[model samples]
Target: MISSAPVIILHGGAGYWEGKNLDSVNSALREASRRGFEEFRRGSSIEAVVEAISFMEDSGVFDAGKGSVKNSEGEVEMDAGIMDGKTLSAGSVVLVRTGSPIRKALEVMKKGKHVIIAERKGNSNTTFNSGKGGDTVGAVALDLEGRIVAGTSTGGISGKEPGRIGDSPIPGAGFYATERVGVSSTGIGEVILRVLPAKEVDTLVSMGILLDDALNSVVNKVSRMFGKGNIGMIGVSKYGDVSAHFNTKGMPRCYQNKEKIQCLVFDGDFS
Candidate 1:
């Protein structure tokens, strides 16, 4: 039995933000969810996903579009991705500076032949040597029209090497959606890229696996496969089943549906 209204889920990031209070992070997640649900009620899954991510990006509390962390050279190199389930269309942008990367991802999905832009030459040599700032923000929403959309934005890791590209702007790596499911992810860009955890979750769910079972099983497998690196994700099925899992200290997250609005900093399984 599904609720009458739509459902939206958001994640501030997957790793720890040193010295920051959970209350403040929880507030940002709550505000983001509330704002995004407004758009969902207006019947636009696309707008809902963007609006939700925009709130977190503007909050400056998360490492996303505006307040993103700087690279080893102290420059901001951002990545973002978005996917619309109904149309099976997606977009992404990398090494971007200015405005919302999520918005640019949408434009890319609509206009470009390529899935991603500006191919970086090599992987960040410091992927495993990161110190703070691995946060990425994202949202998944199932709109009133039964459309599911997913989007993610990130500033990359703090002190990362310049030209270091992560999973955030990769379609299946950081975000994915289909008529049945939508997924968004955060954590160590290197591991997430290797695992493509978001797309894996959607793939499992499409195989008729239960949403929670699919997410938990895949996340655990990814953690085992990677051996090291934080990872967290949020997913929503078209029927409004929602779940989130993080293999880290905490993941600032929030969820809103017809029944309630809940926000929390998860240090445990919050599915």
Candidate 2:
């Protein structure tokens, strides 16, 4: 039987942070940590973690969900993805206006589709309306039952043209997951789309590289291709090992635990 220890991970949207208040951001990080821990304690699967994180993402206070960035046209376009490691199944939606793209993506995954991108123009459905501000957020969970799942969501690039879409909601870009490894990222959408960093990291893991090393290799490659700057990711391996890395000035705070919750924030120089 699989062990009963549950693990949950989350990310605030990824972007350039120059003048933002560190204390306030830390508080938000703590809150997300609390929610994640609580869900884990409640016997909730990674699905619950994704739903709770979506609450954080939807709260206009962060750069995702309702408060997501506006395109050059001043409109929001969103993207998201979800994967079930146990089943090796995944789903994604892109350029959508839904509130919780992550959950919608999970629904699609349960329906047996490997990928499901939300159409810009399609028959009106409430699922497509869940992502309000085009913000993207992602989540991954590993329950004591040994089932793993991953998800990603985003608001499209700031100042992008009306139809411009990045890789946040793409399966291989913003996030990737499998029973063996899990990956999630935040940064330049174009660069992510071009290289499919998340899946690349998974491939590295499949090739026997440790999760942290795989993440570093992928981030380094993207940095070189897109110019070294603020690209970052948070990932956990199948063994419940966690690591965070970035190629730019700094990445935001994140926390993890199977015992008690802890939040780690980096506001200083990248090292």
Candidate 3:
């Protein structure tokens, strides 16, 4: 059965190896999910998404914010996005040099005048002490009032071209939300851009496809075209159906679908 209460899910990235001493990774994921859900109780879905992504960006354990990987020019560029399911409104920033990319994304969303913005200058921040492997951070949540939201943050693919932007800042590509569902994706930005996985999942779910089936089909489709180790996604429905699926070896997450990195929120169970 679908849940009507507040709920949230998050991901650190789509790659990992077994027995890699993921203590830091697991701790950060748990903290983000727990804190994000608390934000939901106090505010709404969008707030929860923002709070969680922000934390991950700062945690330095992933490829976003403080720990964002360096591009080919040995520069750090970042991307972030947010979407409101209740209104289909969005905001995003690309090639940002600031560490607070999530806040910038929120600013764009709040302006309601533009869907995307770009940046090329302004470099501030050093890598976090624990920041390491994970390449992106994403979240999806359903609030107590039925609002669903999705958001993502990334430091861009390591060794990418200096000014290149990925799916992270593209509305339907990296993140998407509608009245029925909210989605956030992490993977090879270029491939994700072509498939627009987030939007695709929203379309399928709206067409009466069950959540699991919809996610499964998308993963299968991506696998057929791009092979594995390319994508990971997390989502929440208005009625509180939560899911995480990835085509990569694994993604740091809080749900068990064959394998999961962590499960700290909602009592480690999904309704």
Q: Model 3 misses residue 130 by how many Å?
A: 8.7
Q: Residues 98-195, candidate 1: write the lDDT tens digits.
A: 66778888888888587887634343332221223337999999977889999999988888888899988887888999998899988888888888
lDDT of 2 by residue, 1-271 (tens): 1112476666665555556665665566567666766776666556555765577665554556565676786566666777777777788766666556666776777787447766565332332223333224556667777676677677766677876767666677777778886777777777777888888888999999987788889888887877876467777677777666777555554555655555444543212
Worst 10 residues of 1 by lDDT: 125-134
Q: Give per-model TM-scores.
A: 0.89, 0.84, 0.91
Candidate 3 residue lDDT tens string, 1-271: 2444577788888765456557888888888877787785579888888988898888888899987888787778889999998988899998888668988999999999999999858765555433355778999888778898889999988788888989988988899999988888988988999999999998999999877677778988999999988888888776677787787766777632112224632112343
Clashing pairs in 1: none
Give each model's whole-structure lDDT: 0.81, 0.65, 0.80
What stretches of model 3 exceed 4 Å from their correct place? 1-4, 125-131, 255-271
Please give the range of 10 consecutive residues that has the lowest summed lDDT in model 3: 258-267
- Going through the candidates in the order shown, the clash numbers are 0, 17, 2
